[model samples]
Target: MGQRTLVVVPRPDGGFDCRYAHWGVTTDPFSGSRPLGRDWSGTAVCAELDAGYDRLLVAAARPRWYCVCWLDPTLTDPDDVVLARTDDPDRLRERWTEAKSRAVDAVARGTAPDAARAALLLGLARRADACHRADDASFLRDDG
Candidate 1:
């Protein structure tokens, strides 16, 4: 089994609640009914990373979302922030544009979910150091 990835608790309405899922506890939803064809094996998220690093990674991997590492915390295990920001507004803007462009390309090509997941994880791991230098710590909550 994989190590603890996030921590979470039951949601009021249930349904694989993504809310607390970032905190690492995934259950049979609030309704407690088994969803048809639900795969809880390889995708099990254990506990919230020491500081919710995985959550941040997941959010950054958002195709239509901004990559914000500062909101999410990082640790020494994988070592680094995913979305390392820069002080230069022009540079940051350029990077954002490039990222959006790449994401568009990926979607256009219909990249597989597994591949997308790997890309996001790897991207954050490689940018870990940079994310720290930028000193951006943030977290995202998917209320939906």
Candidate 2:
């Protein structure tokens, strides 16, 4: 398996202040995006994850929103990351699980945070899947 990155934007209030635009990049085998993900928006929040096999992802969220961020297209991106954890493994997993559960609720309820995050995460997931097919790194590569 290769390294993966899971980025969790922890907006305790579930609302992410989007006024501060975000940005990122992938430094791996492929430099630029071969099949870049286009700009996306959910519940008025805008996000942009690069279409590269492994790449840049920029997004904004509010406290009222709940959503999980990760590499979901076969999940083989060496750069895929999850939220930073502490020395306590149980606490880390607990936090991850809670975030996911809340996101599901947000999706079902259609309220703030959850709904807002769902919009962006779902869109990002679809785009990531599309990139997997478009770019040729749908799974773990023979060489990392």
Candidate 3:
């Protein structure tokens, strides 16, 4: 099976809600005509999934306004976490650039490249890219 990604966002009650995308299914209930699924609480749900809740804590450390946690299954233990505060798209772009640079540097320094780290970085980069593309598409659609 291919890699799976779970995204968690904050809810009003100061807890978190999560959704995942894998195979041909996505927990984004709004993406289709299907009925909406109940929001999964971060702590309880992550525990149930056997994914570490520490990652959610890391994501929560950022400003609480609009942050997100990206859980990638391809990453190794303890490093599969990416916390992004999505209020500013520029921040996401910067993160992606920095991660890519770090991955490249590790390879160039003759150190064994960390596959999990690299995979997580690439996942973040893709997410950042997708966010920007969605913004552009929305803008174009509005203009048209």
Highest lDDT: which candidate? 3
Order of models, best TM-score first: 3, 1, 2
lDDT, each prediction: 0.33, 0.30, 0.38
Candidate 3 lDDT (Cα, 0 to 1)? 0.38
Per-residue lDDT over 11-111 for candidate 3, one digit per residue giving the tens place of the 0 to 100 score: 56745555454422223322522221345444444343322321111123242211133333323443244444244444554565466566656656664
Taking the tens digit of each residue's C-alpha lDDT, what string does model 1 give over 8-127? 333234322232222322232223222222222212322222322433222222211223332211122332334443333234434534553554467558865445445645554454
What TM-score would candidate 2 get against the native?
0.24
In model 3, residue pairs whose N, Cα or C atoms come closer than 3 Å (at least 3 residues apart or on different chains), thus clashing, are none
TM-score of each: 0.27, 0.24, 0.33
- What is the TM-score of candidate 3? 0.33
Q: Which segments of candidate 2 are over 4 A away from where they belong?
A: 1-81, 112-144
| Residues 1-144 of candidate 2: C-alpha lDDT, one tens digit per residue | 221221223234543222221222233212322322222122222232222211222222321111223422332342332222123323433444455566556555655653544454454444332222212221111111
User: Every model's Cα RMSD, please?
Assistant: 14.5, 16.5, 11.7
